[model samples]
Target chain A: MAMAAFRREGRRFAPLLHPNSITAPRSSLIPQELDPEGVRFISTQVVRNRMKSVKNIQKITKAMKMVAASKLRGVQTKAENSRGLWQPFTALLGDTPSIDVKKNVLVTISSDKGLCGGINSTSVKMSKAIHKLNSGPDKETKYVIVGEKAKAQLVRDSKKDIELNITDLQKIPLNYTQAIFLTLELVLVDKSSQAGLISVLADDILKNVEYDALRVVFNKFHSVVSFMPTMSTVLSPEVVEKEAEAGGRLEGLDSYEIEGGETKSEVLQNLTEFQFSSVLFNAVLENACSEMGARMSAMDSSSRNAGEMLDRLTLTYNRTRQASITTELIEIISGASALEG
Target chain B: MASNAAAVPFWRAAGMTYITYSNICANLVRNCLKEPYRSEAINREKVHFSVAKWVDGKPQKPRDEELWHGNHA
Candidate 1:
C-alpha cells in the first residue's frame, strides 16, 4: 500500500492532533540517504546535529507537558465550584429545551496559544457552524470573542460580525475576579462602542450591542485526554420573565419570599446577573482546564515523537560513521599494496 | 397569586441594568452573613489581582479599578 504503516497505526492507536504529522516524517529518507554512493563524511556531522536538536526539542516539550498538567490540577476545582453556582439559576430560569433562540450574541471562549492541540479550532468551528445556522434575513448572530484565538480565526471569515474581542486571559492564572470582569467587559462598551460594558450593552440591540440571549461556546473539560465543546444558552431576564408568564414552568418561584427593600423585578435582575457571572466563571475555568489538558497531551506526544526521531537518527549516525571509517581504511591498505607492486 | 398587586422592581424604575443590581445585591449579601462562615467563604474566594481593559492588542495600563467592590473585599 502507498500509505505509511504509521498512518493506520496512528488512526487505530492514537486518534489525536498528529493526524497531520502522519503524512511524512523525516525518517522516510533513511533508505535513500544512507545509500553508499556519493556519501560524504559531513553527512555524519549533519545527523549528529539533527540528533542534538531533537533531544533539545524533546526536553522542552517534556517541561511544557509538566506545566500544563499542574495548571490543569489547579483549575479543575474552581470550575467544579462555579458549576454549582449556576445550577440554582438554571432551576429558576427553567431551561426549556425546545425554545427557539434567535438574535443572540455568541461568546466563544478560546485561547490563542496554538500549543493546546485542537481546542481553539474545535471551538471556532462549532461557533462558525452555529453562526451559519442562526444568521439569516430575519435572525441575527453577532460574535463576542472572549479569547483571542477565536477572534483570530473568526476575523478571517466573519470580520463584520465580531462585536468585541478580549485577549491576554490565558497567559495568566484565572480566578473569580477575572471571570466576572470577562462578563462585565461586554456590558461596558456603551455609547461609542467602547471596550467596557458587557452588562449595559447586553441591555438591548438598539442602544448598544444587544441581543435576546447569549450562547456561550466553550470547551467542557472531561479528563486529561477528552474534552467536549459545549454551548450554554443564557436568556435575558426580560425574556425569561415573559416566558414565565406564559409557560407555567416557573410557578415554583412564587413560593419563596424575596424580602429586600428592592422590588421583585430588581431582585430578579440581580439574581440573573449573579447567576450569569457564575456560569461565565464556570465556562472560563472549564475552558482553561481543557486547554491545559489538551496542551499536556499535545506536549506529551511531541516529546514521544522527538524521542523516536532521536533513536532513528542515532542509528543512522552510527551506520554512517562506521561506513566512512571503513572507506578510509580500504583506501590506505589498497595504496600500500599498489606501492609494493 | 397577587396579580393585581404586581409592581415592577425598583431598580428597573431607576433604569439600572441587571449588572448594577447584582453588584448591589453582592454588597448586601456579604453584609448579611455572620463571621467565621463569612470569612471562610470570602477568604477562600478572594482574588486579589486587578483586571486591565484589553484594547487593540494590549491591556490598558494602570488597571487600578477592581471589578468587584463589596464588603467581601
Candidate 2:
C-alpha cells in the first residue's frame, strides 16, 4: 500500500522537477557549474524539501491506518451480532420445498478505489467462476454490481450480459429497506413475470414463486489480517416448496406465522424485504471492512518501503558531501606546499 | 494552530496523498482476500472433500484440523 502511495507521489513530484524549475539559478553568488557551494545548497534544499513532504505523507498514512482499524472493529462486531438473525432465517429456508427453476442472479460487492491489494480483481474472478459453474448459454444469468471497481471489471471481462450495474452505494446507508428498494426497482419489476416473481418471492420474501436459486458474492471479514470472498445461496421458493412437499411441513415455519394486523401476503412481503435487506447489508458491510483491512496492510508495507528509500538516499548524500570536502582539503594542502617551496 | 486541512492548500500540501495511496492499497488487499483468494480456497477445499469421499480418502479440513490439534487434542 505504501508503494502505491509512493508511486502516486512520484508521479505528482515528477512535473515539479522540470529543468526550468531546478536549473534556474536563484542566487548571483557564483556561476551555475563552477559554484559548488550553490549547487550543494540547492540540491540539499531540494532533498530536504522532498524529505519533509514525504514525512508529512507518512503521518497522514499512519492516521488513516488507525481510522480504518477502528472502523473495521466496529463493522466486525455488527457482523457477528447479525449472525444470530441469519440462523433462524436460514432454518426457515431449509424447511421450504425445492422446485425446478432455471435462472441465477449474482450480486457482487467490491470497492471503488484501488491499492487495497487484490480485492476487486479477486471479486471479479470469483464472480466469473461462479457464473461458469451455474450458468449455461441458455440459462439466464444476471449481475448487480455494488462498487465502481467491480462494475468496471465485470464490464471489461463480460462474456455474458449484465442485468444491473449499481455504483456509488458506498455513500448510501446499507439497510433492509434499501435492499428491498433496490431489489424491487431492479429485479422485481414485473409481478407476473417468472423471473421477477421468482426473484422477489424466493430468497427473502415470504416464499412466493419458487426461484430456481439465488446467490450473493461478497467478501466475509474474518480478522484484520484475514478475509475471504464468499458466495452464499438463499434457498429459492422452489427449494422451500420441495422441502415442504417432502414431509417438511410449512405449518410451523417462521414465515407462516403472521404477526398482528398483517395478512399472510403482507407478512411475507415484509419478511422478504427484511431477508433481502439483511443479505445486501451484510455484503456491503463485509466489503467495507475488507477495504479497510486491505488499506491497512497496504499502508504498512508502504511505510516500510519509504523508510528504506530514506536510508539509501541519506547514505548517498553523506558520501557525496564527504567526497567534496576531501577534495577541497587536498587542493588547499597542495597550494600551501607549493607556496613554501 | 490552524486545522491541518485548512492550512494545507492542496491534497499534496496537506500530506494526505500518501494516506490516499495507503487507503487504495488496503482496499486492494481487503478485496483480494475476500474474493478470489478466499473463495478459491474454500471452493477447492469443498472439491477436495468431495473427491476424498469418492476415493475413500481421509478428509482433512484445515480449520477443523487446526481446531482439533490446537484447541482440543
Candidate 3:
C-alpha cells in the first residue's frame, strides 16, 4: 500500500522531475570528460549554429527565385514578339528542300552561366544527335558552339568537329544589332572560299559564298514550367529557290516586274542575308527565355528543401530544451527534500 | 511600284523603304532567276550607321568573303 502511494506521487511529479542524465553531478567536484550535461550543452550549441546557416541559405535561394521571375517576364515578351515575325518568314521557306552540300554547320545555342537546370545539357544532346546523323565519309558536319556550357560538354565528344566555340554572348541582354554583327562574323569565317571563287566575269560569285545548310539547336520555352530542346534547319538559297520554282509560284512572280535597273541575282542575295539574320535572332531569343525559366524552377526547389530541414531542426531543438528544463527542476526538488529530512 | 523605284534615287523613291525593298528582294529570290542577277539584286541593300546609302553607284565596301580571305593574303 505504501509503495503504490509513492509510485502515484512520482507520476504526478514527473513534469517537474529533471531526468538524472541531464542534471549536472553535484557529488563530483570535477566534471568528467563523459559528463552528460556537457554533452547536451555541446549538442545544443552545434544544432543552433547549423540552424542559423540553413536560414541564411533559405534567404539566398528565395531571392534568386524572385530575380529569375522578374527577368523571365521581359524575355518572354521578346520571344513572343520575335515569333510574330518568324512565322511568315518560315512559311516562305516551308516548301524548300533540304540542301545537299559537302559540309554542313550546326550552331548550338545555350547560356554561358549555369545554376539553371538542364538547359545546357539538352542543347548539347540535340547537337550530338544532329552531328551523329550528319557525319559521314562523303559529307562533313562542323560545330559552332555559342556558349561555354555546351562547349564544355561537346569538346569531350567532338573535339575535332568543333570549328568555332563562341562565348561572352550572354554578358548582356541580346539585341538585333548584336545578331546582325554576329551573322556578319559567321559569314566571314565560314564563307572563306568566296574570294577564290570570285571572278570579274563570273555571274555565280554570290552563289559560291553560300553555305549548304545550317542547323541551329536550342531550348524552346513552352510554358512557365517547361522547356523543350529543338532543332531548326535552314536551307541554302539554292534549295529555297528550287522549292519555290517547283511549288509553281511563277504565276505570282509573273504579275510583279523587277525594277528596270535591279538584276534578279542581286535581289536574291539580300533576301538570303535577311533570312539568316532573322533565324539566328529567333534562336537566341527563345534560348534566353528557357534559361530564365529553368533558373526559377531550380531555385524554387532549393528553397523548399531548406524549409523542410529547418522544420525538422526546430522540432528537435524544442524537444531537447524542454527535457533540459525538466532535468534541472528535478535536481532542485531532490535537494530540498534531502535538506528537510 | 517597280517603275517608281526605278525612276528616282533610292532615298527619294516613294514606298521604296528598306522594308519594302526587302519584300521585293525576297520575291525575286523566290523566282530562282539565273546567276549574277539573283546575286546582285540582294547585294543592293546597303545600310551603314542606320543610314541607307546608295551602294549601286558608290564605291562598295569589301564584300564579307573578300574581307575574310584578304586577311590571310
Instruction: Give all candidate RMSDs, comma-separated.
Output: 10.1, 21.5, 14.1
Write one digit per residue (lDDT tens) for candidate 3, span B1-73.
Answer: 2324443446324323233244444545534656676554333322221101112222123232111111211
Q: Provide i-RMS per model in Å.
A: 7.9, 22.9, 15.4
- lDDT-wise, the better of 1 and 3 is 1
C-alpha lDDT (0 to 100) for residue A171 of candidate 2:
48
TM-score of 3: 0.65
Give fnat of each prediction, in order: 0.08, 0.00, 0.00
Better-scoring candidate (TM-score), 2 or 3? 3
Error of 2 at A237 (Å): 1.9
**For every model shown, what is its TM-score relative to the native structure?**
0.73, 0.59, 0.65
CAPRI level of candidate 1: incorrect
DockQ preference between candidates 1 and 2, better one: 1
Error of 2 at A125 (Å): 1.3
Q: Give the per-residue lDDT digits (tens) of candidate 1, residues A1-341.
A: 11233323444443355433543454543333343433333245566667888999999999999988888898988787778877887777766533556677888999857788999999999999888878778888888787767877887877777776666665546666566656665543233322223222223322344667778889999998999998877776676677766767766777678785655665665666666677788888899989999999999999999999898888767765666566667779999999999
DockQ computed for model 3 against the true two-chain complex using alpha carbons = 0.03
Off by over 4 Å in 3: A1-42, A95-101, A189-210, A242-265, A331-341, B1-73
lDDT of 2 by residue, A1-341 (tens): 23323323433453566523433443322123332322322234444555666677777777777877787687677676666655676666542212224677677788877767777788888888887776666776566566668767877656244555555544433333334334443334233332232232233222122235556777778877778998766544444445555655554454465556533443343344455556666777777788889888877877777777667656655654555566557668999999999
Q: Which structure among the candidates has the greatest lDDT?
A: 1
Candidate 3 lDDT over residue span A1-341, tens digit each: 23223323433443368444322432231222233332323135556777898999999999999999999999899887887655765655542324455678888998888989999999998889878778788998877777778868876767766665556665556655445544544543222232332232123222222356778888988987798898777765565556457655322433446776655543544455666667777888889899999999999999999999899888766765665566657768999999999
